[model samples]
Target chain A: MTAAIVALGVVVGLLGVLVVGLLRSHADVLRALHDLGICEDDLAAAGTAEGRRTAGRRTTRTTGEIRMVPGVAAPGASSSLGRLVDVSGVDPHGGAVHIGLEGSRGLTLLAFLSSGCGSCLDFWRAFATDEVEQVPGRDTRVVVVTRGPEEESPSEVAALASDRVTTVMSSAAWDDYDVPVSPYFLLVDGSRGVVGEGAGGSWAQVVDLLRKAAADAGLALDDDRPRFTRRDLLVGRDRELRADRELAAAGIEPGSPELYAPLHAAPGDGADGEDGAR
Target chain B: MTDVSSYGITARLPRGWDARIAKRPDPAGDPAGPSTRAAPEEGISTRSAPAEGDPPGPLAGTEHPVAHLANFPLPPVRGDYGSGAVELMRADDIFVALVEFEPEAASTPLFSHRGIPRFGVNDFSPHTMQRTIAGMCGAQAFFNRNGRAFCLYVVLGSHALRAPLVAQVNALLAGLEIDPL
Candidate 1:
């Protein structure tokens, strides 16, 4: 009996060591995956409806919180913001093209995508099919930038390019922007430099992320209403003046008792009978 | 202004303007040898048709550099003289093409001008366009610079509005520098 008890203790200790070793290996694998821009949580959440709903709520709530705390960089904020400059590269037809980012009006959306990335395929399709719309109210120019000719096949990029969009094959732009992943995006305000940037798994997610970024930057993304100009303000002032002139002509001056008549019929003041005040 | 230089061509592009310098590609299957084609009477031909049983002719007798500058966004794909992008220009936009020619052509009478020619509003004409675009006017000049032959082609989006646009063009030309081969 003494020998059996000792053997059992040794077996239990070995099992505990084995479990710890397994956990250590699993953690190392997860860390490696994270370094590759993949998180196990994201992978698991990508397929479930509840996870997607939760992600949407989280994005909205986080954006609201960011608005409350202006100028504070959110956790995991991308470093690609404010790094975009002029983008120059050879087109698929071997022609050199330069796109100036300075002094440009409206927003320029730089979509840094790759041809072989599985996650980028959906974005490519969305851009090609016009499923993605420009940021509402802003004249967002979408320029699809791919790796240079040496690293990417121009033919494949051309095939993936949309006629409506301007595609530039520029590996230098990728380096200049310091893109961390295949399907990263940078939103630039020509006058203000880069305002927002992040990675998105789908077109919808990208739009959400961009909208949130724009909001955090204090940009009115949904404010499509016509801007109130100086002329409008002048017209409003003129209308008010005309109304004041008419009121004065009718004997209603600044100190007119009629303006305060509604307040004078109160019970505390005793300006009228109790029944009238009531 | 942004300084854009490539292949010995340099230009200071103003704000709202962009430029690109590209070397003309060699004729397919044509081995490196002396070009057999003769220089065309005109200094530049916007479009040339392949002659039957004749070797594909290089523009102005050899492959040369072409630089395009415009106030509007230039598309990735464009012809030697701004085909795809010119159509997208607004009424106030400007497109400039600085095309180089063979060194020998520098001595030809067509390219005898000493330096880049300055343009005035009267220099632009609607009929000068490779393809006549409504409300658009174009001007072309052939000149020699540092033993190099070049053609300057400028297009104005509006003929009536060419005065200010011409001033912008001359300002751009004033900043252009071409290095000797």
Candidate 2:
């Protein structure tokens, strides 16, 4: 009777786990597959098409980790990325809001632009026409960082914006972002973080990264505070101790807990150094 | 610098042309792997990979840079260069073609850069050499360098062999009248 009971419980548990896993992240899984370019209709063709390496070139026969290209190495970008720069070069109206906020965060910048770039003309015209929002910490009634070449006359700036656009004439601190091209705004998140190879012509992609930059600035607002969480290993110990209680209850003979107390660990976290197996 | 002495043609072939030539055993013995999937009825090793006793692929063109060397022998029928066997992909009227060049297999391009030319001997006809080379056993024409060099390419699957192979084949033009580039 006891064996029959245990068998029934195991079956029920497995079925429940399967159903829950399927319900969660099914949409993300589908998106990941689509991004990976896997499709049911062209599965066979796709396999052969992308399956081979560059045409005529011999397939590289080396084992793992030996790289072909040199110098351009990825130092280490493990966690979330850093600050992004959004260069806005449009303004409408006179001096009141025109000349302001160029050198705020010790950041150097250079923006090569004129009203000539079609995409820039469109975005600037929109901001000048609409009320823009101010980025936090900076003393500004309206938003948007609009600075450009010294050659650009006030009339050209006016031509790009409307009464609503809040303009700022900042210094072209060139060394700050390592300005590669025109209308390029490079943002260094801090001394340690830098953003490169960003969207140059595509405004939509730039705007998305711009929003990410704002979010990144907000993260920096924690400023001087020493913030610690489970990743710091301090509070995490309490959580680990609590996890022990649950495992203890789940083990054989709870209070006494089978001669050896069950130790909890991740693949590499074990003190016994079995981590090398991974 | 492989021991080419095993191939009967080695002594007759020049020492300078060695790097461009790799002798491999005929894959006719292995009934599996890629060569097995080739034109098995023809008895030639069809897989693009070279087998023992095979020659290199087609030469790029008539004006192949090394065409001047009179003594350079094309890859011999049966020799081993440590990179498997030589593969011969083409033999045509445009050029007498034999492909051999091992890029990564052997330590250097041509071990010691030493070579020999066996075909340049008095009796062999360089002008009508296409028919003589096409008769090589295993595989027929394979391209060593596509059209890049004065090289010829016999199609494999849908693509052609690349440059490194062509350079080797060009080096094989020993005893030809053309001036060295």
Candidate 3:
């Protein structure tokens, strides 16, 4: 009987705290509305379920646009794989490895990555799952070149160690080739010559580079365009929807809806002054 | 023979003059002279010749290539020199250099005298090339072309060659062609 009485007292105390908290939250909202000079009637309307739902819809309607800058079109990128084979590093199983034109045979895709880089983590998933060998017309191999001791690599990088994907722990190759930035790529031919080199700012750009290299080698690519994953699309959509709702709630109008859309160059459209920042 | 086609500027050579593009070597490897951004260790010292049997550093026994009219190794080679700036012309006591920098993302006072937003080196200072500028005048100018910033630096040691070379430099600037952004 005493135990039952204690349980009842605990439940009653929890209910009282919750009720007081709700009342305080309502009072705070009303105070904010008063500070904003909202009339009592308008405040009452905002408190209604219909008014709140309409406000939410309006918030979603005010969304910002994000446009991707077009990547550099591949030049007449022919193969000139380097004949000098500079040894990059030992593999995970303690085997020697060569990258780019330095390798003995096949096309070597050199990926300059760092464990601390956020972008590398983002695109690494796509890169790992992409059916690189099925690209037709070339025997492609991927090698990741990074810095520091192999054992000290982050979990994301350490997970990429395998027979298919060789990881190196040195920047010597990068310095030798004068790679300007991280996540850069160098495509090499069977004869150890450079086919093409470019910045891998996005997974799409990297895929496009490889496809272009394959195409330049006179091989047809089988719909080689990089496609976003289902998760990527869903997450992106959710973020946009949230942004629209939040923007509406904050009373910020979406600036230039067309900027959020894909850019289609119209006839005689002068320079957009967008390149100035890039 | 001063038609330097690189960096989109064409410079015509005056009679009895010739020119070729060359990358500037690093002082650590080739201490031939100091550059505009030369470091403290790259002192304003006289060009030194190495004693016999001395191992080669970059400038150990080699005379200044421009002064002696010899070939200087091109850059993009590790531990040699910067890959950007190149010696466009070296004839008599005059040296013309050209450098190209990637475009700036936003126009933030990249150059002086022009309010126009552009990209490039705004803080360039002239460095004395001891071998070439023993007794001469040097000047550098900046401009934007083809969505890249270009630096045209001229060093003239002989007073006799300055006027003619200035005219050639002007001609090079006049014939410049930059693709629209």
Candidate 4:
């Protein structure tokens, strides 16, 4: 009973602060809350009114810098040996045993990713479920390149490698390969000397190419585009959704509403800015 | 775009012909100017100070890429030494443009400026290289360097930005201009 009374006093104290602070600060707490899509009642309930106002202002400021990804300038040149491959932690698949590109498999699907990249995760999960033997025109072998080492758990590596997602931790993916954001895929054709690269966002695109190439090489597998549903957006198979979540900190900003909506929906904010901030 | 094959002077254009002109900040004073409304955290209201015609300091003269190029020395690659002020006729807006001729291609290039990326630098493909400039402002200013001199393309932008963009670009590039290649 005492605990309940203390909680009520605390709530009343918070309410007093939020209301008094707004009147004194002249802060536009209402618009900020609306922009964040936070319900009014929830703000009222976040303890003191000051708490809600602070929360609202903080959220709005964060949303300001996120704009869409600029379009690609050119189809970059196809990477050659030094142009694509970097040995020793360059393309790690979690904790999977390192196999040199010179191994029986001379090819590596250089998938560049970040710890918080959404598109990279989408591609990773999709490729796992799909078969590799029957792709019509692409090769079947694969390797992963990622930025953050601390975020890569051994279990995550083991899970992806079970389906052959060999991970390589390499800064060269960004420094040498020109991967600015996460999920940039490079399909290395070492023997023929051609590294076809496109759409780093989706692993399915990579898998589809691999399947097709394998089929052309007399290896056949049933691989198709993995159509993602709304449910998949919430708890995706891959954890790179962290990038999408992190973007809320840098996405929408307070500006002319009409001009900003379009930018909020661009890449880096995650699939058309699905984070509700867009 | 005219028949100026023997032209000796540098030319420029504005940006308004193509881009959407953004409305300047509200008339209640300079929108970009400091707001009378103090941020809630600081609460430092300076409205009571002097009613000067414009905000104070060196900010008055420091404007556009042309101004920056004035003090800057000739880049490793340049056709001439001079700066210009190019505004987009369509936008009538204030902005700065930084242009460089192709590195591999002749320092003096040529073309009509159009599109986002504008032109491919390495490929030197005509108008095929257009991409938006990230972190700066609108439009990428790539020059087709396949083999042509760079200014030949500056002549092209002279017609495209419609007016302001090229004028501003050339004004900055003007300081570095020499006799045309």
Candidate 5:
């Protein structure tokens, strides 16, 4: 009886290993299907397995960071983002306002901008216009966050303040949001934490953000017309091409980032090392 | 004047000055380091560095011009110079550097020498070359030829030595010529 028990234990161990191996193979098949762009609804399209596709959302790679494109909310999208913290900053009207990010009844776009950023400057004119009062979606609000101290900021930044857009200059709010680049956009749902974050260089890019935010919230814009057109996208692309030409005309290759980085100095920093009368 | 040819270009060395050319390997290799020894006349090596956080080692002791030729590595930014080799020639109280850099396809804008004195040989006129101050330097010559640019940076030990080194730096700058393949 003891000899038979030892043989039975060996057989059971082999069965366990086989089960684990099968489970691993099944997981591999599922991952391969996801990589092939087979959604959960189409898992049985190719006569493959009938199981649901893994719920992992595809991550879009952008400069310096990975961002998820707007799509069906992946599992635990809300739980993944922690709560937003309250930050104190000064409004454009010189009033002290606590930005709790909770008072917005609908979607709120926090546009992180800087007076020094060339990209942010491109959208300043559009931002100063009356169109900013009605940012495409219903009940959505747009808030501009600039670095604090009104006296230290450029006049162009101050020009962005109007009835439609609320301009706040708060270094504390900028740090709290962990924004590293200017012309960055954060779409926040009312008390729902961050819904999406992206970098925008122009007003069209901002419009693009509104469109994506509206889509994800299962909300439709009151206006059927799209703010961005094929020509508008091409115009943005042309700006980059023109910059390359100017650099090339200067005999500096636009492709060399290291060389270009040094050539570009902040205004009044003096690219040339020597001062006057040297 | 001694005619020194390297990297498909020819440059005139200072009357008694010597130059050792380092070439880029065909298959590409590491950038030139501080490997070349000091010349017998210069009586200095390029291998010395000050202890961490210390002021430039040799200049610490005296105000008098010292002849200390040290090997300084190429700067972090690579220049148009084929082999990024650099050396600091400290003669008496003057600092002279021979640097090479690649020229970009776009023309680098020429700066106006409004208040500064401009001096250069006829050889540089065709190349849009000019003499400008490099931050209290005794004199500085910047010129680009044959898709490469050269900067002859000279800092005199004292204002007293300015007159003596001015001619020497100019002659060295005039001697620079591009070797057309």
Candidate 6:
């Protein structure tokens, strides 16, 4: 009986050691997956991450305490500000096309999507149905950018394109924008450059992310600034021309008394009832 | 510069310019055609007397290819001659349209020009504008290229500034290529 008891104790010790080893191995696997941008939720949902990179440069996540916002994911570490230069690439029809982003008036949303990415299907379908308009509003133009013909099939991109959206297959644009993954977005204000960028699981999340980004950038979507009409420009020009003609007819050239007389008038003595003199 | 080609028409757009090449939708809603939607109007509507009658639909005839290039943002929906987009132009803005006709029209008098016509400052006129918007000028050229009949219509935001603007238009046209239909 004493021998049997000692043997049982040895067996239990071995089992404990095996259990500890298994736990450590599982933890290491999880850590590696995390490094590859796969989270526990992703694993639980799909069993395997779609478009999982087997071997390549990994995108570095931002360090420090990240305050996660509900619905909107934080931007990747590669995000930056500045004008997005012209995007040159081949269209779905195999013709080369260049899209000028500089000096434009409104926002241009560059959607980095891939035909092979399962997550990107959601965006493609949304764009086809015009649901993307709800996110950026009518003022923003959406341009879908995919990898070049070498990395992607132009026919597949064409099949996924919507007549309403302008799609460009440009691998250079991906490199220029530092796109780390598929289904990423960069919101560029024509005058202000890149104001927001990030990834979202769905269009709803993207809307929230862009809204937060624009707000943080101090851009109001409701833009109430007055726009000058063509008539206004013409009227202003005509008034200036007429004033010049009248002045010339009266022989009132530059530095004439008539022009300076209004300025030198005493306060509250001007025709317009405003102070002309200090 | 970027080369955009579709339906046998091609253009090389310069920096700060946007372009599109597409075919008008079949009015009969052919499943094989590009689209089934009606063609958009080419200019702002100014209601004439009812006796003058409403203008004919822009795409009332057979379907053909159309291309648009603009120095400013090109809206997804616009007329062949830029009705919807012209309203958004600034003083320095420009819109160019290249509309193709049936191959048989290549010999017609309107399309008598053998090749693309060069644009000059005199080509643009304020009275030639589609909608008569102040400060805007327009020019049109009908030509035949490689058995295809084509019309090149250009709109400038400022008629007084057509010298430099027409030069830009001519430079853009210089890079245009039309493949056999």
Name the best candidate (by lDDT).
6
Q: Name the lDDT of candidate 5.
A: 0.44
The parts of candidate 5 lying over 4 Å away from their true place are: A1-83, A150-156, A217-278, B1-181
C-alpha TM-scores of all predictions: 0.57, 0.25, 0.28, 0.26, 0.32, 0.61
Arrange candidates, best TM-score first: 6, 1, 5, 3, 4, 2
lDDT of 5 by residue, A80-182 (tens): 2334544345544333333335322345677777776667765566666765654666556577788787433534454454434556677876677776657
Give per-residue lDDT, candidate 3, residue B59. 21
Q: Write the per-residue lDDT of candidate 5 for residues B22-92, one digit (tens) a residue.
A: 22121222222221111111222322211322212121111111111111211211211111222221222
Q: Can you list each candidate's DockQ?
A: 0.08, 0.00, 0.02, 0.01, 0.02, 0.11
Q: Assess each prediction's global lDDT (C-alpha) against the native.
A: 0.69, 0.30, 0.43, 0.34, 0.44, 0.70
Model 4 chain A: worst 10 consecutive residues (lDDT sum):
A90-99
Worst 10 residues of 5 chain A by lDDT: A55-64
Clash count, candidate 4: 99
Alpha carbon lDDT at B30, candidate 1: 27
In model 2 chain B, the worst 10-residue window by lDDT is B62-71
Worst 10 residues of 1 chain A by lDDT: A269-278
Candidate 3: tens digits of C-alpha lDDT, residues A12-46: 99999999999999999888866655546754666
Report the Cα lDDT for residue A93, model 2: 25
Model 2: runs farther than 4 Å from truth?
A1-48, A51-112, A134-171, A185-207, A213-278, B1-181
Candidate 2 residue-wise lDDT, A1-278, digit = tens: 99999999999999999988887778677677566544444334435655443322212211112232221222122312343332222222221111112212222122233455564554454344422332222212223334444645555554453334334333342223333333543433322344322323433444454556645554432235433354656658645643453233223234664456566645644332222111
Name the TM-score of candidate 2: 0.25
- What's model 4's lDDT at A4? 100
Question: Where is model 6 more than 4 Å wrong at Cα?
Answer: A1-77, A90-97, A128-130, A136-138, A148-160, A226-278, B3-10, B24-33, B36-65, B126-135, B160-163, B179-181
Question: Could you tell me the fnat of model 2?
Answer: 0.00
DockQ of 6: 0.11
